[model samples]
Target: CQELPLIPEQDSRDIEVVCNLYESLLTLQRQGINGIWARIIKNAFAPLFNKEFDYVAGNPPWVNWESLPENYRQDTKPLWQEHGLFPHGGMDTILGKGKKDISMLMTYVAMDKYLKKGGKLGFLITQSVFKTAGAGQGFRRFRLGSGEHIQVQHVDDMVELQPFEGASNRTSVV
Candidate 1:
Protein backbone atom coordinates (compact mmCIF):
# COMPACT_ATOMS: atom_id res chain seq x y z
CA CYS A 1 0.00 0.00 0.00
CA GLN A 2 1.46 3.37 -1.09
CA GLU A 3 -0.82 4.99 1.46
CA LEU A 4 1.29 7.21 3.72
CA PRO A 5 -0.55 6.36 6.90
CA LEU A 6 0.46 4.65 10.11
CA ILE A 7 -2.11 1.95 9.32
CA PRO A 8 -2.89 0.66 5.90
CA GLU A 9 -6.59 0.76 4.97
CA GLN A 10 -8.00 -2.62 4.01
CA ASP A 11 -10.56 -3.88 1.53
CA SER A 12 -13.29 -6.48 1.62
CA ARG A 13 -11.09 -9.02 -0.11
CA ASP A 14 -8.59 -8.78 2.73
CA ILE A 15 -11.30 -9.65 5.22
CA GLU A 16 -12.35 -12.61 3.14
CA VAL A 17 -8.81 -13.83 2.60
CA VAL A 18 -7.83 -13.66 6.23
CA CYS A 19 -11.08 -15.13 7.46
CA ASN A 20 -10.85 -18.11 5.11
CA LEU A 21 -7.16 -18.72 5.77
CA TYR A 22 -7.39 -18.60 9.53
CA GLU A 23 -10.53 -20.64 9.58
CA SER A 24 -9.15 -23.53 7.54
CA LEU A 25 -5.42 -23.23 6.93
CA LEU A 26 -4.35 -25.00 10.09
CA THR A 27 -5.11 -28.44 11.45
CA LEU A 28 -4.92 -30.11 14.86
CA GLN A 29 -1.97 -32.16 13.55
CA ARG A 30 -0.05 -28.97 12.65
CA GLN A 31 1.02 -29.31 9.05
CA GLY A 32 4.06 -27.22 8.28
CA ILE A 33 3.75 -24.31 5.88
CA ASN A 34 5.13 -25.62 2.59
CA GLY A 35 6.66 -23.00 0.27
CA ILE A 36 4.96 -20.21 2.28
CA TRP A 37 2.50 -17.46 1.37
CA ALA A 38 4.48 -16.35 -1.65
CA ARG A 39 3.97 -19.72 -3.27
CA ILE A 40 0.38 -20.07 -2.04
CA ILE A 41 -0.95 -16.73 -3.28
CA LYS A 42 1.18 -16.32 -6.42
CA ASN A 43 1.69 -12.60 -5.80
CA ALA A 44 -1.97 -11.66 -5.65
CA PHE A 45 -2.04 -9.97 -2.25
CA ALA A 46 -0.41 -7.74 0.34
CA PRO A 47 -0.74 -7.36 4.12
CA LEU A 48 -4.32 -6.85 5.25
CA PHE A 49 -5.38 -3.92 7.41
CA ASN A 50 -8.40 -2.50 9.20
CA LYS A 51 -9.29 0.26 11.64
CA GLU A 52 -9.10 -2.06 14.63
CA PHE A 53 -9.85 -5.43 16.09
CA ASP A 54 -10.04 -6.88 19.58
CA TYR A 55 -7.14 -9.12 18.72
CA VAL A 56 -5.10 -10.45 15.88
CA ALA A 57 -3.03 -13.61 15.73
CA GLY A 58 -0.63 -15.05 13.24
CA ASN A 59 2.25 -17.43 12.81
CA PRO A 60 4.19 -15.35 10.34
CA PRO A 61 6.95 -16.73 8.17
CA TRP A 62 10.29 -16.71 9.95
CA VAL A 63 12.88 -15.46 7.49
CA ASN A 64 15.60 -13.00 8.45
CA TRP A 65 16.22 -9.69 6.67
CA GLU A 66 19.79 -10.69 5.82
CA SER A 67 18.61 -13.95 4.31
CA LEU A 68 16.04 -12.23 2.10
CA PRO A 69 16.98 -11.66 -1.52
CA GLU A 70 18.19 -8.24 -2.58
CA ASN A 71 14.92 -7.57 -4.40
CA TYR A 72 12.77 -8.06 -1.29
CA ARG A 73 15.07 -5.79 0.66
CA GLN A 74 14.59 -3.16 -1.99
CA ASP A 75 10.85 -3.76 -2.22
CA THR A 76 10.05 -3.37 1.49
CA LYS A 77 12.48 -0.54 2.19
CA PRO A 78 9.78 2.09 1.88
CA LEU A 79 7.72 0.58 4.68
CA TRP A 80 10.43 -0.58 7.12
CA GLN A 81 13.27 1.86 6.50
CA GLU A 82 12.33 4.29 9.29
CA HIS A 83 12.56 1.52 11.88
CA GLY A 84 16.18 0.93 10.78
CA LEU A 85 15.53 -2.79 10.98
CA PHE A 86 16.93 -3.63 7.58
CA PRO A 87 20.53 -4.47 6.73
CA HIS A 88 22.85 -1.44 6.69
CA GLY A 89 25.90 0.35 8.11
CA GLY A 90 29.18 -0.58 9.87
CA MET A 91 27.75 -1.42 13.31
CA ASP A 92 24.98 -3.47 11.74
CA THR A 93 27.50 -5.37 9.62
CA ILE A 94 29.18 -6.78 12.72
CA LEU A 95 25.84 -7.64 14.36
CA GLY A 96 24.81 -10.14 11.72
CA LYS A 97 24.06 -7.11 9.56
CA GLY A 98 21.50 -6.12 12.19
CA LYS A 99 19.25 -8.73 10.72
CA LYS A 100 15.57 -8.70 11.72
CA ASP A 101 12.98 -11.26 10.82
CA ILE A 102 10.03 -10.49 8.56
CA SER A 103 7.72 -11.66 11.32
CA MET A 104 9.21 -9.11 13.67
CA LEU A 105 8.40 -6.35 11.24
CA MET A 106 4.91 -7.77 10.78
CA THR A 107 4.46 -7.61 14.52
CA TYR A 108 4.74 -3.84 14.36
CA VAL A 109 2.59 -3.57 11.29
CA ALA A 110 -0.13 -5.79 12.70
CA MET A 111 -0.22 -4.03 16.05
CA ASP A 112 -0.46 -0.64 14.42
CA LYS A 113 -3.02 -1.48 11.79
CA TYR A 114 -5.38 -3.92 13.44
CA LEU A 115 -5.03 -3.94 17.21
CA LYS A 116 -7.08 -1.54 19.28
CA LYS A 117 -5.45 0.61 21.91
CA GLY A 118 -4.84 -1.31 25.17
CA GLY A 119 -5.46 -4.53 23.34
CA LYS A 120 -3.37 -7.60 23.94
CA LEU A 121 -1.13 -8.91 21.18
CA GLY A 122 0.37 -12.35 20.96
CA PHE A 123 2.62 -13.95 18.40
CA LEU A 124 5.16 -16.72 18.04
CA ILE A 125 8.51 -15.12 17.30
CA THR A 126 12.15 -16.03 17.59
CA GLN A 127 13.42 -16.17 21.16
CA SER A 128 16.42 -14.16 19.99
CA VAL A 129 14.13 -11.15 20.40
CA PHE A 130 14.86 -11.35 24.11
CA LYS A 131 18.45 -12.64 23.91
CA THR A 132 20.10 -10.58 21.15
CA ALA A 133 20.71 -6.90 20.70
CA GLY A 134 20.63 -4.40 17.81
CA ALA A 135 17.41 -5.08 15.88
CA GLY A 136 16.28 -7.20 18.77
CA GLN A 137 16.34 -4.10 20.92
CA GLY A 138 14.09 -2.47 18.36
CA PHE A 139 11.54 -5.23 18.90
CA ARG A 140 11.55 -4.84 22.67
CA ARG A 141 11.39 -1.05 22.37
CA PHE A 142 7.79 0.11 22.15
CA ARG A 143 6.77 3.58 21.03
CA LEU A 144 3.27 4.83 20.44
CA GLY A 145 1.93 8.03 18.89
CA SER A 146 3.98 11.19 19.64
CA GLY A 147 7.04 9.32 20.88
CA GLU A 148 5.08 7.80 23.76
CA HIS A 149 5.91 4.26 24.91
CA ILE A 150 4.12 1.15 26.11
CA GLN A 151 4.94 -1.39 28.80
CA VAL A 152 5.79 -5.04 28.65
CA GLN A 153 3.17 -7.19 30.33
CA HIS A 154 4.90 -10.55 30.54
CA VAL A 155 7.42 -12.75 28.80
CA ASP A 156 7.38 -16.53 28.95
CA ASP A 157 10.97 -17.60 28.56
CA MET A 158 11.28 -20.91 26.71
CA VAL A 159 14.99 -21.09 26.04
CA GLU A 160 15.62 -24.61 27.27
CA LEU A 161 12.81 -26.31 25.33
CA GLN A 162 12.22 -27.17 21.70
CA PRO A 163 8.59 -26.38 20.80
CA PHE A 164 8.61 -27.68 17.26
CA GLU A 165 10.00 -30.91 15.86
CA GLY A 166 12.89 -30.58 13.41
CA ALA A 167 12.93 -26.85 14.10
CA SER A 168 16.24 -26.00 15.70
CA ASN A 169 15.62 -22.25 15.89
CA ARG A 170 14.68 -21.10 19.38
CA THR A 171 11.18 -19.57 19.37
CA SER A 172 8.55 -18.46 21.87
CA VAL A 173 5.11 -16.96 22.18
CA VAL A 174 5.00 -13.28 23.06
Candidate 2:
Protein backbone atom coordinates (compact mmCIF):
# COMPACT_ATOMS: atom_id res chain seq x y z
CA CYS A 1 0.00 0.00 0.00
CA GLN A 2 1.14 3.53 -0.73
CA GLU A 3 1.77 5.84 2.20
CA LEU A 4 -0.72 8.67 2.32
CA PRO A 5 -0.17 11.97 4.09
CA LEU A 6 -1.71 11.77 7.49
CA ILE A 7 -4.44 14.34 7.73
CA PRO A 8 -5.20 14.10 11.40
CA GLU A 9 -7.62 17.03 11.54
CA GLN A 10 -9.11 16.43 8.12
CA ASP A 11 -12.10 14.17 8.27
CA SER A 12 -14.96 13.20 6.00
CA ARG A 13 -16.46 16.65 6.51
CA ASP A 14 -13.37 18.43 5.24
CA ILE A 15 -13.66 17.06 1.72
CA GLU A 16 -15.48 19.76 -0.20
CA VAL A 17 -17.65 18.28 -2.93
CA VAL A 18 -19.19 20.56 -5.56
CA CYS A 19 -20.12 18.09 -8.31
CA ASN A 20 -19.38 14.55 -9.33
CA LEU A 21 -20.25 13.43 -5.83
CA TYR A 22 -19.72 9.73 -6.44
CA GLU A 23 -16.40 10.24 -8.13
CA SER A 24 -15.22 12.60 -5.42
CA LEU A 25 -16.17 10.07 -2.74
CA LEU A 26 -14.26 7.32 -4.46
CA THR A 27 -11.23 9.57 -4.90
CA LEU A 28 -11.36 10.57 -1.25
CA GLN A 29 -11.39 6.92 -0.23
CA ARG A 30 -8.43 6.19 -2.48
CA GLN A 31 -6.57 9.16 -0.98
CA GLY A 32 -7.28 7.97 2.56
CA ILE A 33 -9.82 10.66 3.41
CA ASN A 34 -13.00 9.19 4.86
CA GLY A 35 -15.91 10.20 2.66
CA ILE A 36 -18.97 11.64 4.30
CA TRP A 37 -22.12 13.43 3.19
CA ALA A 38 -21.61 16.28 5.63
CA ARG A 39 -19.89 19.47 4.53
CA ILE A 40 -20.93 18.91 0.99
CA ILE A 41 -20.78 22.53 -0.06
CA LYS A 42 -18.86 24.48 -2.63
CA ASN A 43 -15.70 26.08 -1.25
CA ALA A 44 -16.74 29.34 -2.85
CA PHE A 45 -19.91 29.36 -0.80
CA ALA A 46 -18.13 28.81 2.50
CA PRO A 47 -15.57 31.61 2.54
CA LEU A 48 -14.97 31.35 6.28
CA PHE A 49 -14.17 27.66 6.25
CA ASN A 50 -10.41 27.37 5.84
CA LYS A 51 -8.58 24.06 5.86
CA GLU A 52 -5.09 23.68 4.47
CA PHE A 53 -4.08 20.84 2.20
CA ASP A 54 -0.71 19.54 1.08
CA TYR A 55 -1.96 19.26 -2.48
CA VAL A 56 -5.01 20.55 -4.34
CA ALA A 57 -6.24 19.61 -7.78
CA GLY A 58 -9.26 20.50 -9.85
CA ASN A 59 -10.58 21.42 -13.27
CA PRO A 60 -12.55 24.57 -12.50
CA PRO A 61 -15.05 25.51 -15.18
CA TRP A 62 -13.76 28.00 -17.74
CA VAL A 63 -16.56 30.55 -17.71
CA ASN A 64 -15.86 34.25 -18.14
CA TRP A 65 -17.08 36.85 -15.67
CA GLU A 66 -19.61 38.31 -18.09
CA SER A 67 -20.98 34.83 -18.80
CA LEU A 68 -21.53 33.89 -15.18
CA PRO A 69 -24.99 34.20 -13.66
CA GLU A 70 -25.69 37.71 -12.40
CA ASN A 71 -26.29 36.54 -8.88
CA TYR A 72 -23.09 34.55 -8.71
CA ARG A 73 -21.08 37.47 -10.00
CA GLN A 74 -22.53 39.71 -7.34
CA ASP A 75 -22.03 37.19 -4.55
CA THR A 76 -18.37 36.58 -5.37
CA LYS A 77 -17.26 40.15 -5.92
CA PRO A 78 -15.87 40.48 -2.40
CA LEU A 79 -14.00 37.25 -2.74
CA TRP A 80 -12.35 38.46 -5.92
CA GLN A 81 -11.15 41.57 -4.15
CA GLU A 82 -10.08 39.62 -1.09
CA HIS A 83 -7.79 37.56 -3.28
CA GLY A 84 -6.72 40.51 -5.49
CA LEU A 85 -7.92 38.80 -8.67
CA PHE A 86 -9.32 42.07 -9.99
CA PRO A 87 -7.12 44.88 -11.16
CA HIS A 88 -7.07 48.22 -9.36
CA GLY A 89 -7.37 50.61 -12.28
CA GLY A 90 -10.71 51.42 -13.84
CA MET A 91 -8.85 51.70 -17.14
CA ASP A 92 -8.77 47.91 -17.36
CA THR A 93 -12.54 47.88 -17.13
CA ILE A 94 -12.94 50.54 -19.81
CA LEU A 95 -10.55 48.67 -22.09
CA GLY A 96 -12.37 45.37 -21.58
CA LYS A 97 -9.33 44.05 -19.75
CA GLY A 98 -11.22 43.44 -16.52
CA LYS A 99 -12.96 40.39 -17.86
CA LYS A 100 -11.53 37.22 -16.27
CA ASP A 101 -12.27 33.53 -16.30
CA ILE A 102 -13.85 31.96 -13.24
CA SER A 103 -11.11 29.35 -13.23
CA MET A 104 -8.54 32.02 -12.38
CA LEU A 105 -10.47 32.87 -9.27
CA MET A 106 -10.75 29.19 -8.45
CA THR A 107 -7.00 28.82 -8.72
CA TYR A 108 -6.38 31.77 -6.43
CA VAL A 109 -8.93 30.59 -3.89
CA ALA A 110 -7.56 27.07 -3.89
CA MET A 111 -4.06 28.27 -3.17
CA ASP A 112 -4.97 31.06 -0.77
CA LYS A 113 -7.53 29.23 1.33
CA TYR A 114 -6.73 25.56 1.09
CA LEU A 115 -3.08 25.09 0.27
CA LYS A 116 -0.36 24.78 2.86
CA LYS A 117 2.93 26.60 2.55
CA GLY A 118 4.92 25.24 -0.41
CA GLY A 119 1.94 23.06 -1.37
CA LYS A 120 1.31 22.27 -4.99
CA LEU A 121 -1.85 23.00 -7.05
CA GLY A 122 -2.52 21.50 -10.42
CA PHE A 123 -5.42 22.62 -12.56
CA LEU A 124 -6.62 21.95 -16.06
CA ILE A 125 -7.60 25.36 -17.40
CA THR A 126 -7.78 27.52 -20.45
CA GLN A 127 -4.36 28.24 -21.90
CA SER A 128 -5.38 31.81 -22.66
CA VAL A 129 -4.87 32.63 -19.01
CA PHE A 130 -1.18 32.93 -19.67
CA LYS A 131 -1.33 34.71 -23.03
CA THR A 132 -4.39 36.94 -22.88
CA ALA A 133 -3.63 40.58 -22.20
CA GLY A 134 -7.20 41.37 -21.23
CA ALA A 135 -8.60 39.35 -18.34
CA GLY A 136 -5.51 37.30 -17.64
CA GLN A 137 -3.31 40.25 -16.77
CA GLY A 138 -4.34 40.02 -13.14
CA PHE A 139 -3.62 36.30 -13.01
CA ARG A 140 -0.18 36.80 -14.53
CA ARG A 141 0.73 39.08 -11.66
CA PHE A 142 1.45 35.87 -9.70
CA ARG A 143 1.34 37.76 -6.43
CA LEU A 144 -0.74 36.67 -3.43
CA GLY A 145 -0.16 39.62 -1.11
CA SER A 146 2.66 40.43 1.34
CA GLY A 147 5.29 39.61 -1.26
CA GLU A 148 4.16 35.99 -1.68
CA HIS A 149 4.72 34.68 -5.16
CA ILE A 150 3.26 31.73 -7.06
CA GLN A 151 6.18 30.04 -8.72
CA VAL A 152 4.88 28.02 -11.62
CA GLN A 153 6.96 24.87 -11.69
CA HIS A 154 5.70 23.45 -14.95
CA VAL A 155 3.14 23.76 -17.74
CA ASP A 156 1.91 21.08 -20.13
CA ASP A 157 0.31 22.60 -23.19
CA MET A 158 -2.44 20.45 -24.68
CA VAL A 159 -3.71 22.89 -27.27
CA GLU A 160 -2.49 21.02 -30.32
CA LEU A 161 -3.60 17.66 -28.95
CA GLN A 162 -7.25 18.76 -28.72
CA PRO A 163 -7.89 16.35 -25.88
CA PHE A 164 -11.46 17.42 -25.22
CA GLU A 165 -14.12 16.14 -27.60
CA GLY A 166 -15.83 18.87 -29.64
CA ALA A 167 -14.03 21.59 -27.67
CA SER A 168 -11.53 23.76 -29.48
CA ASN A 169 -10.40 26.05 -26.70
CA ARG A 170 -6.68 25.84 -25.95
CA THR A 171 -6.03 23.99 -22.71
CA SER A 172 -3.09 23.43 -20.36
CA VAL A 173 -2.16 21.74 -17.12
CA VAL A 174 -0.36 24.19 -14.75
Using lDDT as the measure, the top candidate is 2
* Top model number, TM-score: 2
In candidate 1, what are the lDDT values of residues 1-174, reduced to their tens digit?
Answer: 233333335665556666555544453216754325443453443343426888777767788877876766776666575543443568675757476788877777777667887887888788876777666766666653334455567766655677777778887877
* Tens-place lDDT digits, model 2, residues 84-154: 77874587687878878999988987888888999999999899889888778778888774448999999
Whole-model lDDT per candidate: 0.65, 0.77
* Cα distance off (Å), candidate 2, residue 168: 1.6
What local lDDT score does residue 165 receive in model 2, on the 0 to 100 scale? 82
What residue pairs clash in candidate 2, if any at all? Answer: none
TM-score of each: 0.65, 0.69
Error of 2 at 51 (Å): 2.3
Candidate 2: how large is its RMSD? 9.0
